[model samples]
Target: MKHRTPRGFKRIPAWMFHSRLPVDAETRLITSYLLTSGSANHPTVSELSDALCMDAKTVRRNVYKLEELGLLKVIRRAK
Candidate 1:
């Protein structure tokens, strides 16, 4: 039987896992979550922390690491 993916689920690219970039487990988890989160409703640091069951500081630190590695980008909206 063919397996069907759940509706509204984001599909991670295979290249992301096979890339030469060095991504730690936490970074990978964060990246995947971010990728799956819809553009209109991206979770905040606190939300991610709660979802991942990690400290907010830890989540922030990993987010920065992912940014440094070019896996994530921060865009500021004008107030």
Candidate 2:
């Protein structure tokens, strides 16, 4: 399946690659991954962990980071 890159992000800034904090880098990577996931997949934390080759903790942390930055919204569903 082909995915479309989101508008306004046609080019990722080079500075994202040189961020000083490790979390900043991971957050940017997660953002990139999420942008690539496109408008279809709403992956769970475990799934994101698997795709990104990171642990669940790392995935969750970066997800929250993205949320804080207003780049992504995390919806909680009641079980």
Candidate 3:
């Protein structure tokens, strides 16, 4: 049987890689991973750390930096 890829896989625009935005290597990698994850759900710091093979604290720090740069936004949902 032929294997099938999952749906909702999106391609990161080439411009993002070569844009004027001052994004670092780590931030860009994390952003790309999130974009291709196929969901609007946000991943936790632990998840990001595990996926990126970086320390949780490091992931949290980078996430904050991304937020500061307006490259990533956090939306709160009521439970």
Compose the digit string of candidate 1's lDDT tens values, residues 14-74: 5655667776677767766676665634578999998778999989998887677655653
Candidate 3 off by > 4 Å = 1-22, 74-79
Q: Give each model a TM-score.
A: 0.61, 0.59, 0.62
Which scores better on TM-score, 2 or 3? 3
Each candidate's lDDT (Cα)? Answer: 0.66, 0.62, 0.65
Tens digits of per-residue lDDT for model 3 on 1-79?
9633335434445554457666676776677667766553689998888877989888888788777765564222210
Model 2, span 1-79: residue lDDT tens: 8644446443344543345434465676666666566553578999889977899998998887766654464322100
Mark the regions of model 1 whose C-alpha exceeds 4 Å error after superposition. Answer: 1-11, 17-20, 39-42, 74-79
Worst 10 residues of 3 by lDDT: 70-79
State residue 34's C-alpha deviation in candidate 1, in Å: 0.6
Measured with C-alpha atoms, the lDDT of residue 33 in candidate 1 is 65
For model 1, give the RMSD to the true fold. Answer: 5.6
lDDT of 1: 0.66
